[model samples]
Target chain A: MTTASQLTPRRQATRARLLTAAAEVFAERGFHGASVEDICEPAGFTRGAFYSNFASKDELVIELYAEHAASLRQAIAEVAAQPGLTLPDLLERVVDIWTRDPDERRRWYLLTTEFALHAVRDDDARRAWQRLQSQIRKELGALIESIAARHDLELAVPTSDLVRLLTIVLQGGLGQHLLEPRAVRAGALEREFLPLLVEATTR
Target chain B: MTTASQLTPRRQATRARLLTAAAEVFAERGFHGASVEDICEPAGFTRGAFYSNFASKDELVIELYAEHAASLRQAIAEVAAQPGLTLPDLLERVVDIWTRDPDERRRWYLLTTEFALHAVRDDDARRAWQRLQSQIRKELGALIESIAARHDLELAVPTSDLVRLLTIVLQGGLGQHLLEPRAVRAGALEREFLPLLVEATTR
Candidate 1:
């Protein structure tokens, strides 16, 4: 087996392309509906190329989750590093990133929901998903704590609970907005609900 | 063609059984993965019986949404009729009805998510789903108005905005709990988040 260090940059780019293609095809055709051939066709890669990078579709999904999470953390860090950024500004920036691409957002939402349903039934997948979720919660909790300290805001609840609530609102709002876009509108959570939550939690 | 009034009680019961079974099977296998035969087998009905009750799976889904919404309204009415119940009590009671059966709740969540995804792509389905959602929001707004009046509570936001926020929180919270049951817990909305929302909105 070729070690990670042994892989050339060109090979790494091929793997990344395949993963991105898999995400799109899976979102469009669903996990069970989309075949490896379908993903390969769109990405201009062969079946062997897919297998060389990931073991199976399930493995690809886990990697997709990791990639998405990493980018989100990077975005959060970028926003946090801005000078004189308030809680609301940070939230709005993050929401902009999330709601920036409606098509991509919808695709991601579909894939995530599909994976979540699958994870609930599969023990190993659920454990892996939960680990990622736990890490996200920890990162969010730290960010919220830092914001509270920077603003001298008194949090009404634990930082963990606040993070959990934020996750719930985002997931829930996205689901609703996706289903009823005209009513829920894009950025409803960031524009309306998030402010309410922040104000309620902070004295 | 049989008129609605011409149908006997037995026919009505059969229709109800088929719907309930469809909800369960659809939840388990999803809209695309499930077939008419699968739903009929569990409900002990023939394909003819299934077709007689509903034209297609999409039609049955619309019916399921109507039935669920009707039952939710009934529950809200029952709760509202209780003597001397405060807003929090009513909210808690409603949440109880929602979170009462985890299996059923999980099934509903899965089916709803599936339907929502389907609706995004189908115009007719989206309109039908939106009508039901609008009615639900209106009913909720009315309920909140009455509660505020009875309790003489001053709302921090408009009644409509509050209703919308409540829907967001419920949808958001359910999505989180479904994915991370151990961390979020069942009824975390009713027990933890709803109270905070009520406190935030009311003085």
Candidate 2:
């Protein structure tokens, strides 16, 4: 439960490196496909270093998602803080940042998908995932509501549902893109339709 | 390539039984977890019978998806063909049939998701899935266009995008529900919001 900031600077560096390597390995090989040794080699860390930071690969993934959410929240906040930015511009910028790293987007999507399937079948995994997601989802809902309020826009549905709608589009869009990269552009669904949806649903 | 009707009645029965068993087993254990022997026992057949029918588990899954799509299309058509049905009624009926068998719905979603992950990682699996899905999506688009036309409605986007939208919502909603059933209802997103999405996106 120790926060990353609580660790010694050297320990913090090690933790960050492990997460980076884990994300790449898991995204490519999936949750079950990649071994602990596979991830450690890329991170330039020993098994002892990995164990010192996180209990297991599962715990590392949880931390990875949390870090992703925090960074994305920060990015959106920075954009929203810009003076006199119109709602349309804010929406566009948000989408741009979200889609900025297609490689990382695919990584997060693939890894989360593998985690989600595991959560469906295992209670321990479900509890850990649900705990992380519910907290993340609540924070996201509040962030979205504040964004809408700042723009003087009223959404047609609750902010929670709006957040859920966005999640739906992200998963669906990325998955279709995964299946047919040549046909569907990465992030095209959420990028194209979300703005239109927001305009129609907001006043 | 053999159609069900092309077989003798007894062979047709055996094929149907094999499909039923495969769906149940795979849904519970996933694509990789379920063995040929596991599927055979429930179908009251031997491993020899399975090989005679399907080249592999992968081949069986492709056929499973085809049959599911075919039955669902038929169900939608039957409902659409009913006389004097209003647009709202038609929408409701469609959602009802789609959500009618929650067990089977979960089965389809879980199994297809596992297969999709495979398709993402492997080119051969990707081609097999893409071929089936492209054909299915095209027919579904045409079917949807005819439905909209019959109701004298004009969609804001192309029917193809609308079909994609429905898929995104279905996957997003179902996956969320799978993660937290106490919070989100099955088919609720597509059931409730799809109607509104359609209303706003159509004229």
Candidate 3:
């Protein structure tokens, strides 16, 4: 609930550093392996500082997921706003944004997936993560709606269903790319198949 | 490589029990937590019998993966061979097989995913798993090819790409289903979208 903008400049900087340190530590040591002290030491902040910025490691990860999701959503929205582009073009641009971040993108996904496995068994953690995810689903639904309206196409399925399929494609591509990069190049699966989905599932 | 038929009936029964026990043990305790003894205890076998059938835990998981993949492949292949079924009919049947086998299906996916997390970090483990996966890919490719040929449609992408996309859809549905069952029904994503992929990607 506390936004970075609500904090003073120094606290905001501290929070950013802690998030960065958490990303690195979590990526290397995994969710359960990385302790608060481990994350605090690298961020050059004490436990008190970490507590001030984030309530717990779970909160920190949820924020990271929100940040990652927001950046991707914003990037795609910018592309969608471009005048005269088709739905496929907008999708391709979205894939580009997804794959373009290189190291950070890979690290975020690594941390996200590692945490997802942990969260699946933990009720509070899953609920917190899902809250953010539902917001994401709504935004994506609106985006798909706008694109469909622009193209004058009546969708074969509901907007939410299409969003779910897009979600599946995105996560599917990420999972495959993470496990077998050579087999599934960064964005290759989404790029080739998502457009086909739009074409086949819409009139 | 050793088929059940190659073993004596007693050995085959032992191997099957060990596998079933491994599924339960691994599901309860993950890849590293579950010991060979734990698997053996439930199967009513000693660690010696475990070693005779599987070289190690990794081998056991790979074999489990192989078995699960083979059963699904065989089931889908049977559906494909049914006379006069269209591509959508075959796909629906495939989804049914995936969603059916309720208890075993859920357990196998849980074990497989846990092993996958472990395998992602271990090269020897990954390579062993990939060897079986590449086989699945080939089989899926041929299945897609046959269904397309049956429909007399020219595929927009290569059979292999469609297979990869389908693979993405399956895992995407699975990962979501595992994490949030109410949000993504067992076979909902694959059922609605896979046929759309086939319809749109083939001419």
lDDT (0 to 1) per candidate: 0.78, 0.83, 0.80
Model 2 ranges with Cα > 4 A deviation: A41-52, B6-10, B41-48
> Lowest-lDDT window of 10 residues in candidate 3 chain A?
A101-110
Across A1-203, the per-residue lDDT of candidate 1 in tens digits comes to 23335679988788778888888788778876898999999778889988988777777787787778678777877887788987778878888887888887787777877788777767777777887778777887887777778778888887877887887677777877877787778877556778778887888
Give fnat for candidate 2.
0.56
The pairs that clash in candidate 3 are none
Candidate 3 lDDT, A1-203, residue by residue in tens: 57777889988888788888898898888777899999989667899988978888999998888877877887787888899997777888888888887677666766777677766767888887777778878988887788788889888898877887787788767767767878878999888887788888788
Q: Which pairs clash (backbone N, Cα, C closer than 3 Å) in model 2?
A: none
Chain A only TM-scores, each candidate in turn:
0.84, 0.87, 0.90
DockQ (CA atoms), all models: 0.54, 0.63, 0.55
Candidate 3 lDDT:
0.80
What tens digits encode model 1's per-residue C-alpha lDDT throughout B1-203?
A: 23335679998888778888888888778787899999999778899999988877877887787667668767877887788998778878878887878887777777777788778778887887787777777877887777777778888877777876776677667767877788888887556778778877788
C-alpha DockQ for predicted model 2: 0.63
For candidate 2, write residues B47-70 as lDDT tens digits.
Answer: 999998888888889999999898
lDDT of 3 at A189: 84
Error of 2 at B58 (Å): 2.1
- Report the C-alpha lDDT of model 2 over A1-203, residue by residue, as the tens digit: 46897889988988888888888888778888888899999767899888988887778888898899889988988898899999878877887887899888877877888888888888877777878887778988888888889888888887777777877776788888888998887767767778777765677
Docking class of 2: medium
